[model samples]
Target: MKDFPSCFGESGVQVADFSSSTSRTAQNLVSCVYQCRLRGRSRLITVSWSKNLMGQGFSVGIDDNTNQCLCKVDIKPWLFSKKKGSKSLEADSSKIDIIWDLSSAKFGSGPEPLEGFYLGIVFERRMILLLGDMRKEAFKKTSATPVPSDPIFIAKREHIFGKKIFSTKVQFCDNGQLHDLVIECDTSAVSDPCLMIRVDSQTVMQVKRLRWKFRGNNTILVDGLAVEVFWDVHNWLFGTSLGNAVFMFKTNPSAEKLWVSQPLSDPHMLPWSWSQRFQDSQSQCLGFSLILYAWKNE
Candidate 1:
């Protein structure tokens, strides 16, 4: 299974459904992809977390450098009683084991566990990725040797809900300092709504006359690096009360090259599909993409 970003690239941008997704399916869902080097080869591992009426669940998917899925497994805490269990599969001619113990996991408003749990991915008895604080428990359960080299986080997609202020914490680079990201916009309050973005409570980028600039891209500096910000608030201004908005923060590999590479015909067009870019050669230049689907409750 592939983890697709709701926001697409500009060169071949095409609109995708954001307003039609049910609140349950589109809320509290987060997926993260990691780049791991195993046996001298690079591979991607996608871990997705979600919650439903049954309880919380997650899925782990392994893909090769070519973006081909080698194996995947879904763990449902309530249904399959998978709160504490492991699964084994074959990938790259090696035995791949995914072990997890979410029975003691702690969570906040979102689906992801805050702590008190461990999820490990073992390749040929070597631990490639381990999450959560229960490292000792994870190693004891998997009996896999922890490697010195850990995987690098590549991309993430999350669903956020808010009224005027949408807030989240993010790190622009691997092992980078965490920063507070806040997106504030109240279309109804002002005669002309302005979209303001802040990093660590300091306003960095602001779009005035949001009605005309509802869909566009801008570059901002963070941690001494350039980050391209793309947003689409079309549904927020024109669609129903349940309509949602999309925003993306893409960094690494020079955001300038990524934008200049695309045709400048449509200045206000938003991204279409991140999965499509992965298939194209453009994926090599694209570094990290943070896609956020902001749902308004009003």
Candidate 2:
């Protein structure tokens, strides 16, 4: 099989491990979550980018506060004949339009474009979510008014592959500087297994006795904001299958509110409880989370 590079190539790797067969062909995906108001009610938007042997593609989904999907649209991979187009959909009796132009877009090694393109989501001719650098072209093509309130980026989930060193880029807050996130761990070193996490080459967190503390949470400050880090590497340490490790970085002071029903004082308790359901909002304010699933290359 041939190896193809994605447009944004921060962190993506493939291994030849067939121990479980499932981990041998893990899907490459990047999903970004945004919080915004729709018809006076809070809603969430998920934009997912994906790539496979066929080509690069993307999907846009809208969900209500109740966690119900209101609408979704998928743009087939670069079809050559339709690199730029628009689609209109209806949700809750309201009109929604999605437009994009990737003809000249440049990509790194990831499925996401690096520049030269724009993806716009308009509601009633009003721009709701506009991404990419081609802002002027997007407005002219969609004939949309400037956004009244900017959407808040709340979360991002991405899959990465590597051997012992995995790296990616992240921004803790809107308009914040993008920092390099690097995770180094050698699971094969059973005698002295350790884990280290660094941001912008600066070591922010480290773990010893990997076998004992495979699941835990810690806090680190970034850009003057407190970020709680949760990790689960139990699979890498002891699982029979070649599994992936999960890591989440949350940047919300009110994040503790999500665990109000749980035992906060218990040192052995995990805030997320190894579950992927972390959508609790007690306050009107939105929070941000970055989840990375790191898979080791055989």
Candidate 3:
């Protein structure tokens, strides 16, 4: 199996279909729908409430080969009452947890489900880093915390090497220049993790470190940063950021240039219209609709 990409690259998972009602004198009412997709299938697995008082929620996982239910798990909370002030409280109190075993499941058998193909994990000795927006104070506090000794699970087997993450992008950087590894820890439960890059004589070390401050509501963070040594021409292309915008530095480390696609104002214009000359050879020519609108007082 392939190694999983860090959470920094993982796409967001969203839960939908929640409805509730409550009275001023009572607890808040809540009901929600959770949906998950089965690997390699067009079917979407949905879990929701049942009208029966004893039946809190039900979950279903589909098998693509059979086009039938692979597993059906009932989630009945230990306690539930319609008269209760909050529907969510009742559901939570009566909910059941179920873990599925797919060893004998058909997801990975036969032709191998398109969504269930496990990509080979690619490991690199170089340290990984990330950078993004974060609260200034939180960043400072985390920086002062002591590093931890435990191994950090950057990605789960199902997430990185699993068959689910297909056609997704992965980026890696290894520059010789030292950089501050910044990360934003959003919850009090999770300690901010760090990557320590060090080199001695001929050996290179990438250490996993941790910080103390609880990230709180801050969602943006500078994951990590590094300056790479130029070894070969191919390495140069892969060493830089993979996004559309990147900062390039000169040999002196004093001069820098901002490389960006020229802004296109015409609503009908395609992204290729604004491509820089250097990117023309490597870029794909794709057209997309561009909408522009502004509100005006009548």
Off by over 4 Å in 1: 1-22, 25-27, 253-286
Per-residue lDDT of model 3, residues 1-298, tens digit only: 0011111111211112111111111111111111112221222122222222232322222222222233333333333222121111111123212222212222221112213111110002111111112223222422322112211111111110111111111122222333222211111233443322222222222223333211111111112323221111111122222111111111212212222243222112213222232123123211111111110111
Name the weakest run of 10 consecutive residues (lDDT summed) in model 3: 1-10
Sort by TM-score, best first: what order? 2, 1, 3
- The estimated TM-scores of all candidates read 0.83, 0.84, 0.16
The local lDDT score (0 to 100) that residue 15 gets in candidate 1 is 21
- Candidate 2 per-residue C-alpha lDDT over 80-178 given as tens digits, one digit per residue, 9 for 90 to 100: 348788889887789899999989999876778889999999997888899999999999998889767798887787778788999989999976889
When summed lDDT is taken over every stretch of 10 residues in candidate 1, the lowest stretch is: 6-15
Error of 3 at 64 (Å): 3.1
Better of 1 and 2 by lDDT: 1
Model 2 stretches astray by more than 4 angstroms: 1-26, 78-81, 257-282
